[model samples]
Target: MVQIPQEILDQAKELRAQLHAAPELSGQERETEGLLKDFLKKRTTLELVEEDGWFYGVHREGDQLPNVALRADMDAISGENGPYHGCGHDGHSAILAGAALACEGKTLGKNLFFLFQPAEETGKGAMQCREMLKKEKIQAIYGLHNLPGFPLGTVMIRAGTFACASVGITLLFQGAQSHAAYPENGRNPAFAICRLVGELSSILSPENYQGLVLATVVHLLVGEKAFGVSAGEGELSLTLRAHRSEDLALLKEKICQQAEALAQADGLTLTISYQDEFPDTTNPPQLCQRFEAALKKSGIPVSQLQEPMRWSEDFGWYLKETEGLFFGLGAGEDCPGLHTPEYEFRDELLAKGIQSLLTAVFL
Candidate 1:
């Protein structure tokens, strides 16, 4: 294993603390972006490319060498009051920067690209970063997420799907309004909305799908609060997830069909919209073997996961375009779950995360 100086590790911890204290939301990380770029500029000898909304640092070895990419997300999740760093993205970005610091004066066989991405919480960041894959001719990519329920310093690996695909579906129901005294004169969609909600369980039944599939009702809005007028419109929001991309597509189709039938019967116009769409994050078996081999060569502890995580990751977008592996770095067995009020990234994992990145590129 490459030895990183304790002073460099301390610098990384300081950066993580600063990031955690002042968190920014997705697509609005101007200050956060500047902070990261400044760190890279002052501390490293990498060539920095500042894009319109994001940035990356490149370690040039040779034009003929293969290009390897490493990515870390740079945004926070929403909390009760405002933007919060509940997802440990602050640590993620800092760890990647630490790796850049370790590689300041070394020449690995491949050209290394350190990608600091924004808007990952909304599943839009990777969509923007995918262009870099083609532009850099990135042959392979590697990244890691910190897992809370595992032993610290241990690396988690999965051969197939590592994270599920998910999408947000919004259903708008429009109908004619009527006075409370003569409700029969206008169309009402309360019954249709209720029925659609009721059928959610059946639509995602286990027997209908080869792997895990789920539909969660995140929001429901009826009509006006006034009692004098009958409701004219309503909206329903659902988050759908599946282990396979094909199943996610089918789930959307099934739910929309059901909503359309219900709306037609109630004489209401139904409109469907989507947001926060993410694809399944799959690791090719060969790449998984390579990751495991890299860690083993460095004497790092490693383990395989039995099932795919239910949460979605935008890193899936990059894998769709090139070969990549999205592994997990264990935080601790008793660590707080991600995106929770009590969660904070452990500073000690900085070294391990940086070591893993160095290993992948040097291999």
Candidate 2:
């Protein structure tokens, strides 16, 4: 194990706590960038640049032709009304910062890049940064997420399709209003909404490829406030996630087509909006071998995950640019699942994550 400095750990913990107190959602990671910017600005001799709040700091260690990058996400998941740091992203960011601080004047075999990516939760920012980083001669890039299901200090590393593809769905239902008593006076969208919900719930195949389609009316709006009048207009926001991108595409098409058909039959108009798409994340084989070698050399408990999770990350885009492998680090036994209100990151894993990154860079 490398002998990391106490000040480095202390500074990392402080940065983690500061970031934890005010977690920002995807694409709105200003506080994250600010924290990392301030923490890394005066600590080392790396070159830094910010692209749409995404921070990339290049450490010029040697004249190696191919560069190695160690990356950590800097954005939080959606549904953060106030600042819930449950995902341990703070620990990831702090570990990246600690790695940067530790490698201040160390001898890395190649030019090292520390990528502080934004919007990993939503799956857009990684592709955006990937386009920019594609111009550079990067031989390998590495990334990690905090794992709660696994044991602490146990690295969950795998090659090929570790996560599934997902899509975000939003729908709107619009119709004419009428008096509550006069049944035929106007078209009530409530009936249409109810029918759509019912249809969406029961959409499944009789054979294999078994999956569920959930149509939750997250936001509902009615024109009239009084009970005497029926609702004329209604809106819905739904999220569609599946194991296969083809499944996602087919389901989305079917959802819109079914909803449209239902609305047309009910004398109503429907609208759909889906954006910020992300595909399945597949880790390269050679890169995964490199990670396994590094982790083995570092003497860490490592495991190849059994199943590919439904969760998606934007680093899928990074794989398109250069050879990269994204892995997971365990926080603790009882850490909360991500995006929960009571989710708080464990701070003690900072040094361990940093050490892992250090081993990667030195390789």
Candidate 3:
């Protein structure tokens, strides 16, 4: 195992604390980016490249080695009071930075690139950084997330889909309003929206698809709070998720078709839109094998998962452009789950996270 020096570990801990103390929201991580960039400059000799909203570090070995990239999300989630690091992105960014420190004097054969991405919570970060893969000619990439409810230091890997594909869907209905006494005179969408909600279960029945498919009704609305005015508008919001991209696409089509039919039946104008889209984070077999071998060589405890995670990861965007492996670093069974107010990143995982990255590139 590659041992990280005590002083470098100390620095990493300090960096993680700094990041955790002052978190920024996605797409507005100016200060977060500044902190990470400054940390890299002070610790590593890797050439830094700055982009519009994100940045990366390049370590060239002068050998004709294949370019490999390692990525970490840097943006925090928006909490009730303010932005906070409930998602542990602070730990992730520090891990990549710590790895950069460990890689400074090493003579590795691979050209290593470290990506610090922003806006991951909304599924926009990887899309912003996808162009970097093509520009750097990166042959392969690797990334990891800390998984609670698992034994600490255990590495988790999956064969095909590591994370599911998901998208936020919204259906807006518009109709003519009339007096409360003359309800039939107005094209109120209450009946149509209620009917759609009632049919959700049947539409998303487990028997309808081969893999895991889910459609959740996150929100529903029918007109205003005022009882005197007949309701003529409504909105339905849903979150669609599936283990396969094709299944996700088909699920979306089915829901939209159903909504259109309901709107047509009521003579209401319907508009459908989507946001926070993510593809499935599928791992190529060869790359998965390579990562597993690297972890084993370092004697890291590794486990294979039978099913893909239901939560969406923007890292899927990177896999669309190149072969990559996205795995999980366990945060202990007793740890608080991600995005919880009680949750904070486990600083003890810093050295191990760095070691895994170093092994993937240098082992």
Candidate 1 clashes: the total is 0
CA shift at 160, candidate 2, in angstroms?
2.8
Residues 1-363 of candidate 1: C-alpha lDDT, one tens digit per residue: 778899889999999988888799999888888888888999998999989789999999899999999999989989987988998999999999999999889868779999999998889999999999999999988888999998998989999899999999999999888997888987877778999999999998888887999999999988888899888889999999999999999999999999999999999999999999999999999878988998998888889988999999999999999988998989999999999888989998999999987787754
Q: Which segments of candidate 1 are over 4 A away from where they belong?
A: none
Q: lDDT tens digits, residues 73-124, model 3? A: 9999978889999989999999999888888888777899999999999999
Candidate 3 ranges beyond 4 A from true positions: none
Which residue pairs show backbone clashes in model 2?
A: 86-343, 86-344
Candidate 1: worst-modelled 10 consecutive residues by lDDT:
354-363
Q: What TM-score would you give candidate 1 relative to the actual structure?
A: 0.98
Who wins the lDDT comparison?
1
All candidates: TM-score: 0.98, 0.87, 0.98
Per-model RMSD to reference = 1.1, 2.9, 1.2
Model 2, runs deviating above 4 Å: 1-7, 61-64, 76-81, 206-225, 360-363
State each model's CA lDDT, in order.
0.91, 0.75, 0.90
RMSD of 3: 1.2
